[model samples]
Target: MKKTLILLSALTLMVSCMSKEEKMKEAEADGNEAIAVKSKLIEGAGKALQEQGKAAAKSASKGVGDVIKGINSGMSESISQSDVIPEASFKANFEECKAEKIYASNDDKVKKVTIYLIAKNDFKGDLILKAFNADKKEIGRSRLKADIKKDDAQYVDFTFDERTHLLQTEYFTIK
Candidate 1:
């Protein structure tokens, strides 16, 4: 028993006194293993982030597409329901003192009227617009101000109940 114990202690001492090169080689192997594990973890995290970015971009693109479709549908509906009125130009002078018929729609389908006036010279006064139906009955009237310099243009817009046939204009002094 005494001889066996002595031999085991000698073997343990020899192992504890291993060469410096051998110990260094073992430590380097452990470091290489740890680095490989860390590299795999980093690669996995990068892949997850890339997938999340792709998903977010796809969702945002879908949202923008939906908004554009809604706007286009609304615009199409409005254009299909409204009627197109022809543009008309009229000229008026203070000395003429005549009521000019600017526009006269053949049918009773007129819903809105727009009148444009270009000042021949410097003039600051009022203009009266009268709307008549097919039966020659006054339906609507509006007053517009011509506070414009020479060669400048002014617009007068009128919206009525359902229909108008004729739009006449006459110039009057500012009171």
Candidate 2:
């Protein structure tokens, strides 16, 4: 009976001592597995961020392109016309004043009509400009006060505040 008890004690001591090494090895394996999972998660997150950045850049590029197209179309819609409709007041001063150049143009969506005149007599009054469409309907009007002497050349600018976007000003009149 004493020999049996000694044998059981030795067996228990051996098992207890071996369990420490086994536990250490298992813990090391668990740590390596956790590191691998973390590395995979980081790589996946990096890939997702890269894809998101690429998509954002593509969308911004498209937005800029659309804005450029809009600007180009707006620029193409600008107008410049030299045709002028003669009125009775204009004919009465034909010998005293000569209309050299007359044109209407648009800049930044604003309409501007200009008239270059050579005066052969002394004049001091307001110059009125009336813009019209194809049907001869008055669309806009502008007035400028000016004082001029004989044999003087002057440039007059008239700006339209309303209906600035319409390029249908086929003709205009001066008074």
Candidate 3:
């Protein structure tokens, strides 16, 4: 028993001692260094969940933009009958506003529509929310009402039947 205890003691000593706190601190330091390196390599990757989120956001933004462009171009090519759609300008503006402004979505499942827009005071301007069906017919319209000062953000929300909504457009003007 004494010899066995002695062997066990030797093995324990051979495995260097590190407190949990100390190990965690060292790990955190290494993690910070890794984050710095990754930031330099991918730029925006260092944001919060450095590994998963930033890339996803950038990719999604690009994809959505491309889709919107395609839609606008397609619309302009076939929409000669409509004098109201600003075709080119509106397409660019929609993507730009989406990238610049932060908006939230509220879904009306029963109505089969999702309304997304910058809320009242998102900007010192009149914000228009327009919903269209797949047939390119207007289904709903609302103007955001709120007092927003310079550099202030706004919360916008609207609801319609999800089934009826096909393409949504937002128009904003600064007053």
Candidate 4:
């Protein structure tokens, strides 16, 4: 009977030790899985933050470029306006026709002249515009078709070639 009791006690101890070992192994496996999941989450969060930063930087760069373009445009306009000389003379070679307004428009490396005319007689012909410098030297010339009614007004635009120095004109004549 004593031998039987000892044998049963040994069997119970062995079973308990095996159960504890299995439980420990399961806990270790769960811990490893949790660590792997945490690593993936961290990596995903880092990638998301990096993408946001890139987008923000790109937007800021575009905004700065637009501002610079606006400033350059403003400066060019101011410089062009200051270069024009007021009190420029304009002569019309038609009877009872008066030169009303003359203005110079500047473009990229070129200049254009616009003339407003008022007449009391019906006229239809090709109008020749000649621009001269302060020294009376002819600098530019352009021809445009004009059709003016009696007691009415007309606007004529003369576009000169790129080589013409129309921007430095001091006087002009229309015939």
Model number with the top lDDT: 2
What is the TM-score ranking, best to worst?
Answer: 2, 4, 1, 3
Pairs with backbone N, CA or C atoms under 3 Å apart (clashes), candidate 3: 111-161, 111-162, 112-161, 112-162, 112-163, 113-161, 113-162, 119-155, 119-156, 122-154
List the candidate 3 regions with Cα displacement exceeding 4 Å.
1-95, 99-126, 161-175
Candidate 2 lDDT over residue span 1-175, tens digit each: 9999999999988876757779899999999999999999999988997989789889999999999999886664344444666567654543333222233443455556666667757778877877777797888888888787777777777777746433677667777
Stronger candidate by lDDT (1 vs 2): 2
lDDT (Cα, tens digit) per residue for candidate 4, span 1-175: 9999999999988876757779899999999999999999989988987989789889999999999999998865443322222222222323423222233444464456666677556778877777777798888878887778876876666778877764466666666
lDDT tens per residue, model 3, 27-88: 99999999888878666534545777778889999999999999998875343211233244
What digit string (tens of lDDT, one per residue) describes model 1 on residues 1-175? 9999999999999888868998899999999999999999999988987989789888999999999999998865443222222123224332212232233354754444455555666777665555544454566655566677777766555444443333321121111
> What TM-score quantifies how close candidate 2 is to the native fold?
0.45
TM-score of 4: 0.40
TM-score of each: 0.29, 0.45, 0.26, 0.40
Clashing pairs in 2: none
lDDT of each: 0.55, 0.69, 0.48, 0.66
Looking at model 4, residue 98 earns an lDDT score of 25
Which one wins on TM-score?
A: 2
Which wins on lDDT, candidate 1 or candidate 3?
A: 1
lDDT of 4: 0.66
